[model samples]
Target: MGPEGGGDALLRLEGVSKRYRRSGLLALDDVSIWVGAGERVGLMGPSGSGKSTLACIAAGLLSPNAGHVRFDGVERSGGGRLPRGRSAAVRRAWLGMQMVFQDPEASFIPTMRLGDAVFEGARYLPRFKGADKDRLVREALEAVELPGSYAERFPYELSGGECQRAAIARAVIGRPKLLLCDEATSALDVTVQAKVMALLGRVHRELGTAFLFIGHNPALVGGFCDRIYRIGGGRITEELEACERP
Candidate 1:
């Protein structure tokens, strides 16, 4: 079994269940999982196995028909609560939660400059404006090791790896306490995938962000995650603890 949830867990999904109205699909069934502060948790299963649905609910985008979500010890149902509340607008307020998608191209706005897009999330942070904002934008770009000049370039002007890195940069800029990644490296080639993994490693080890990583590769999960949960048919079927690290 995985470690139990309590006051220390940064995020928790308890007895969570969801059904897609349009498809009449039971996306999740009595699933319970938790991520502790600064911990790395891996969720893995094959495609069409409700991994993305779980991610959506965790991010507070989709409401579950049953069960509850808790962030920072507060339980949320129908939707998640932010620092102050859980209205639709509050959901968008981004209270310590962020997501990184697999397809970076689809996530970015075509017309927006890369720099503008990367720092957009930090606008939600308090005391964020002027020099600090600009500095954050640059720092976020640098976090992914993208060149300063690349910030001014459009997403179309960059390679896939660069764009994906920018997407990660955007996700990390706000310094969200928890990052829910839905196959964040699937679109990149092997080399770029390694780079993204390394970036995520630093984000996990250095920034103290609890990560709920959704992916298919077991090896990758073992390297970065403290615990690995195998989710199947909308429920967690197994939990694998990481091997002792050097």
Candidate 2:
């Protein structure tokens, strides 16, 4: 990746804003952020600072009231309704812009086997089938250090840390260009969090996947990301190239 706005950016958010209808709260305010191809960027903020809200807009999960989201050099905006085909294209981009939430259990399909759940989203990709699909699932699980036999198990059979690892596996299975981690390791015990953090680093290094880590922890972000942005009041307040790590 080159300088901030130089070419080769994988994702970029330009002057985005969002507000909630219920309470009329402004969640994001003219926020601009970018992640270059294979770059690991970190976002840190206090609770309710809207880092997660910005992540949603960046991933196309929620549309912003203003500004645009650009991915793979294609500019997309959540500021307004899009044409049906454009919406579908956004959804397709989302498949490659996977996210892992704080609670893995909340995202699981209780009835589906772990392997099947991991492979669920990839079937839509053209000609991705049979042995290739199966291999992808197994490889993804292995990437997160989950045992091969875990694939046959169900979500209830795994511990919290194990489930989170499975969640990482599921996200990477699609070979996403961007990975959004919203407090992904915050729920785990210290030891388990360390393991998950290590797994994330390994994934970033091995896959060359750009990661946008959203959390309140400065040390975690400092240790993992190449660039760090601090957010408050729905806007990026500071850019810190150095922070105390680990």
Candidate 3:
């Protein structure tokens, strides 16, 4: 996907602004940035600093009061109004964008089987049915280094790290071009977090997936991302090259 204004960016935000309440407390103030294809950019900011708000806008979940968001040159509305009848079509065709949130436990269905949970979205694609869906489910599970038998287990049965991996497998099963990771590894133990980060890096390299890695930890971003953007006071305060970090 190309950037806005005819460039190489996979995602671009231009003069985007958002405010809450009548007093006009800005969550985002005319923020502008571009993420190139296969580029991993980390977003760092303290709590309540609007990093998540910006991420929500980028993911097409929240609409901006002003400005434009372009994904692969296609304009996206900040409002969550997907076109009628075409919503499914757009989602299926643009399987390149996926989001893995910070809290995997909140995202998964506690009652559903692990396999079903991972392949839940796949049911929307008609081409993947019965055996095809089963195969894809197995592949996704394996990709996350989970055993095939895990398919029968429920969310409560797996450890926190395993559950998170399952969530990631679900997101990647469709082979998205852009992966928005909003503090995805924040909840895991150090060892588990390292494993997940390594898996994500490998996926990015192997599939050429562009990653928008959002987090507060400089060390975590330094280990995985090529560039880092520190957001504060409703705007990006610093843009650093990871290679230059000391």
Candidate 4:
């Protein structure tokens, strides 16, 4: 399976490839995928099959050896080079994207309070500045079922599930158009994972945010995604529609 009709997609990756220099391993090979606006797409693969690598590349956190990443109809970057000056400025203003990692604790600053970490990104935006920032943060936390008071506590103080919820609050505070979930629920317990999945569903419905859910669990991916891509051996081997799952 390769990139399908994505002219109107919110995120598009074309012929992407990534190779690690130290290990000389090809983590991804000619991978192509797309997530349309408010669409839920899943990437499923076993460990070390390049699922996380693909997620990082999509999030613009890792540079691919070859390929093009387009977001909102604009080319993001290629060949380890990032946009600069005018291009970078325009991108910053329209930065309607966010990513949540598997380990929520790792996403936070160990020394920072939970509230400050959640407000970090929002504070940079014009609408979330000053008093509005606090309100926005509280609203985000509330949406994630986290108490506003929990914001005062540090990341180490919350349980794993609670921390994950906080991480979600941080990601959604900006009302991103694209949300990347890189094994976001893998670290939680089975019961907690279900709760988190439900929460993500609610968030998607309320915000209409497109999602690229990367994980290894077929059951989880099948349950949450509208379409699923099976990535293995560093490439997408199959694609499945909702009715075709399992």
Query: Highest TM-score, which number?
Result: 4
Clash count of each predicted structure: 0, 0, 4, 0
* Candidate 2 positional error at 65, Å: 0.5
**Candidate 4 on 105-193: residue-level lDDT in tens?**
98999999988899875666666545666677788889899998887899999999999999999988888888899999999999999
Candidate 2 lDDT, 16-57, residue by residue in tens: 999999999999999988888888889999999998898878
Better of 3 and 4 by TM-score: 4
Instruction: Tell me the alpha-carbon RMSD of every candidate.
Output: 2.8, 2.3, 2.9, 2.5
For candidate 2, the per-residue lDDT at 77 reads 40
Tens digits of per-residue lDDT for model 3 on 63-141? 8999888776466643744445555556565456788999887888888988888887566665665557677888899
lDDT of each: 0.82, 0.83, 0.82, 0.85
Of models 3 and 4, which has the larger lDDT?
4
Error of 2 at 112 (Å): 1.8
Cα-based TM-score, every candidate: 0.90, 0.91, 0.89, 0.93
Better of 2 and 3 by lDDT: 2
**Which candidate comes out best when scored by lDDT?**
4
Candidate 3 lDDT score relative to the true structure: 0.82
Off by over 4 Å in 2: 77-82, 86-94, 243-246
Per-residue lDDT for 142-237 in model 1, tens only? 888998777789989989888888998998887888899899888888999998888898887778888899999888877778888899898899
